[model samples]
Target: MTQAAMPQVLIVDDDRAMRASLVALLEAAGWRVEAVSRASRVAETLVTFAADVILSDVRMPGMSGLDLLATLQEAFNPPVVLISAHGDIPMAVKAIQDGAYSFVEKPCEPRRLLTILRHAADQHRMRRDTASLRRRLTQISGLDRMLLGQTPGIADLREQVLDVADSDAAVLLVGETGTGKERVARALHDLGRNPAGPFLALNCATLQPAVFEAEFFGVEGGQVGKLLAAEGGTLFLDEIGACPLPVQSKLLRVIEDKQVTPLGATRPVPLSFRVVSATNEDPDAAQSDGRLRPDFLFRVNTFVLALPTLRQRRADLALLMTHFLEEFASVYETVVPELTQDDMAALLAHDWPGNVRELRNVAERRILSARRGGGSVAAAMHKDHELDDVPDTLREAVAAFERELIGKAIRAHAGRMDAVAEALGIGRRTLNEKIVKLGLDKGALL
Candidate 1:
């Protein structure tokens, strides 16, 4: 099994010797194990370990396992198993009632302990997977199609957006280019208190310094500003970091005073709308470099949501690729072509500097190219643009280079396995194994 597929356990106990013994026992049983002397550290360790089952002693220095159970109840935590020599019927009953998966007294049989842990871990994983499936179903059923992906980062972002959507606070979205900050901002508006109200968007970088206030505040009687236009709704400001200093001051005043004075009007107009701002640049850096005013940044950034880049969530690539491929194929009135293993390998190998937007474009290009009877998806991906030199890992870089070299060799040899193997100085069987391992489409090459 892969490292991610391995069952994981976290042991929390005050006794160092007991922790060591449990770690050894679990590791011997083909389970990944981590142990901590304090129950309090379990939460901190869990941030990275993601244990399927928490095997903790009943008593510890700072916090008892019972107390830990109480805290874990607040979040989506793994099943916890409490163990202690002092365990009794009353304590066991209390632990079970408090959401402990199972209770074991001191000197648990090796086989029994393993069996219980296995069951608990399996159940925890099943429940988590079920919840994730339900969440995806909800997304596809109209929660918001734009904020897609089942990766932990995206899932956490979805939860955060839902949590703050109804509130009328100003939110600042932070992410790299093409990470879909605008989509997130739109989701916030659509799910907010005034979905029926107008959702106005503005790009600060597109507005000249002289026209910024006029566009935001509007002329006296000529036209209404975006703030007024977005009454009872949301005003999304993209590239807020690029807002001019003068306009930032005025914007801050409007946000603070809850009103704005028209460019040629003396009277101030009352405004009621949430501000959802997005910036591809760093706010701190922008402020330091004088591109953004500190007061304006503080005013607009009531809450901040940071979006993850594509490389950070590669696990969701298959789902995202499928979604885009089918979507574009349907739009273009073409059959959904099956992506060969080589296509998948190429998709995974990309650095995706343009994030999800780049993936969507590539998928569309694949459908369009196939409509005109063009080459493979892998070939189409690199037809226009050179491969990004920076790979996320050495392994990925080497694998990608190997895939390219072998693909060229197969084309040169006309897909004759023996000829290709001879040209590459490897046995035919070994070459075939590499073809399968690297996910090359030999038939497509021919």
Candidate 2:
């Protein structure tokens, strides 16, 4: 069945007549409707009914509809159209600012109210379908455990991970902060045959010098360190460059001997696990500076995987954006709104110094803020001049403009690549190539 025919609306009003009327009107209009009398039970009812739009009375006994709206705003972001008997323009304005979909008076025009509800419901369904499709695609793609990316740099890294996963050799992953180094390590562990064994991880930077030895080698009280905890699996040491020289020496000894000497213990414990370490610093420079031992570096550098920065793999930006959009939409219970060409342009023009993590934050903010304002995010972004500024060079300017326009079109059409291409008066293959050349994903723009 088509999405519009499947939308569900929740009617929250104390008056039985109003609730019945809303249910009848919505059902007759080809929408699924559920009627409820109490605001206190809205949350439970929402979960049970899986509402797409919430039509609620502003003032009610026990808990006011405004109170219910505020409470449900966080858990469920369905568009709420408020109805009030005693209209207060200021209160309605405040409600819109606080994320209400729209506000209407009690002596409401049936046609106008129904039209507004239909638009809101349609938008909600679109967002819900987008999110649902993303989740299903992620599962079907079978890349949930492996960080998904199609860039050449990421592909190379994945190949290296697979190669190293087959051996018992130690590996060192190097990358900037928030580059998913730990995720790479986990992927390595999973790819190996011994995945059933414990995969233990600890951040060396967070551990104090005094506890470093005890943490890595265990203690007299029979407490096992991360190394021992991974027995036959993998031990991941995050931020290994931050380890003190003294602690480094002890770790080096364990790597070489395949045994750890626990603190306050006379005997050494035999370890059979593999070691995988990650650092954001340059290992060669650190070794030359006496911060890291050259021998230790060689021991752990049996294999090395260096992750590229976000800008270096700009081709994956759109894919990452879509991934984050789906994630945030599910978490916030909001519809995934379409992006404008200008919004896409801004995203492409901005230098993402913080990488994927930063992009996720921006997408989340845009989605939530747009819903609260009762407007399309793309419309708001179009007003920003930064999206229109052309660069100095013709090639650079054209590329920048194309990226922005394409990005915006995809967003505007809710990531429908065909629709975006048609809107921009371009062929599908040409649009696909442009997206690739611009370092974006067609799906992401959608």
Candidate 3:
């Protein structure tokens, strides 16, 4: 362990000689020690040296050791041992009641004092470790479970989320399609300041220009707007860039003012809720194209959290695949199929344009197919390829068409790469590489 990791004790005594003696004794006893001549100075000393245990003289000038113990109890949880010549049975009992870990009489035996300090330090270390473990457990079962991955991008993203989750700031989630933007949005809400409060989600893309205002702001009827309904909680607006231009301006006003007015009402209702908005479009391009309002974008993007693409975090692919397989296997009550080397190679080579959502769907399909008696992960992946959105450009169209042909040929040839290659008029090596590149797994071909 480093020097900082060593057991540390802060000694507070008004007697100059006693302070020096105690410091020397503790240092000799294999403990890092800092001695202060006053109880008031203990707090300042603690700023630099975080003592695991505080050993202080009960009688001090300004703040008594008891007073320091009281203050430290509220600020931090380090164990405090109080010692004084005036220590009586009643005073010791009262000190313990006031949260001192232990009380010792002065003219104390060095061996016994060291023993008490050792116990105090150990107790403090245990308490700190337990608190840290509890926090890790909370993250594992809650937020980390939802956003599962070991990639640096994902780890950084989790750190960022935890940092801002407790604040009342508006957050913007930027990502590509199927990158779990909504999951991230929900995480921001559930892990936020008001987990128990309402979490209202609205898709701006589905909103029509005519009814968008009335629906969002609420009419003169009994219906309350999302802003009002999400009081003390969160309102997640997905596809925020797709919101009509005029409504975006009004949304910005509501956010900035922390109030909102219904379409038919004259009075503005006080609004209070964290706005967590998401968009797949590039903010700069959207703003330049006039699809997203600049002022509205800036207002919502107080903390812009850019999510990593599936391609960017390919290292987490196997972990995510296993997670999805286990989840879907339990749902379908089937044995999880083990992926062959070829199948894994195919998975690694494929350009996962659809991201995690696509991977999850493939896993579900594989599980369902397994329950039906016989199917391959490769086949499920082939299905995913076919189900991909229509290609927009000539290059993509050609690639998609070529991938489909190769998939059909492999299935027809019964997993024989040689026959498939011969049938396609391509070399065996070319066929193998293409199969891997296309994510058409060997099991599916077989």
**Winning candidate number (lDDT):** 1
TM-score of every candidate: 0.56, 0.53, 0.56
The alpha-carbon deviation from the true structure for residue 394 of candidate 3, after best TM-score superposition, in angstroms, is 30
As a whole number from 0 to 100, the lDDT of residue 196 in candidate 3 is 95
Query: How close to the true structure is residue 147 of candidate 1, measured as C-alpha lDDT?
Result: 77
- Which model is ahead, 2 or 3, in terms of lDDT? 3
Residues 382-424, model 3: lDDT tens digits? 8865645878898888878778777777777787778878877
Clash-forming residue pairs, model 2 = 127-336, 315-439, 339-411, 339-412, 340-408, 341-408, 345-404, 414-446, 415-446
* C-alpha lDDT (0 to 100) for residue 19 of candidate 1: 86
Residue lDDT tens for model 1, 155-273:
89999999999899999999999899988998999889889988989888777768766877888988777678888889888999877777777778888888888888999999988
Clashes of each: 0, 9, 0
lDDT minimum window of 10 residues, candidate 1 = 129-138
1 versus 2: better lDDT goes to: 1
Local distance difference test values of all predictions, in order:
0.84, 0.78, 0.82
Task: After superposing candidate 3 on the true structure, give the runs of residues whose Cα lies further than 4 Å from its correct spot.
Answer: 1-140, 388-446
Q: Per-residue lDDT of 89-169 in model 2, one digit per residue for the tens?
A: 898998898888999997888889889998787777655654554665567443343666768888888778877788888
- Which segments of candidate 2 are over 4 A away from where they belong? 1-140, 143-145, 370-446
Leading candidate by TM-score: 1
Ranking by lDDT: 1, 3, 2
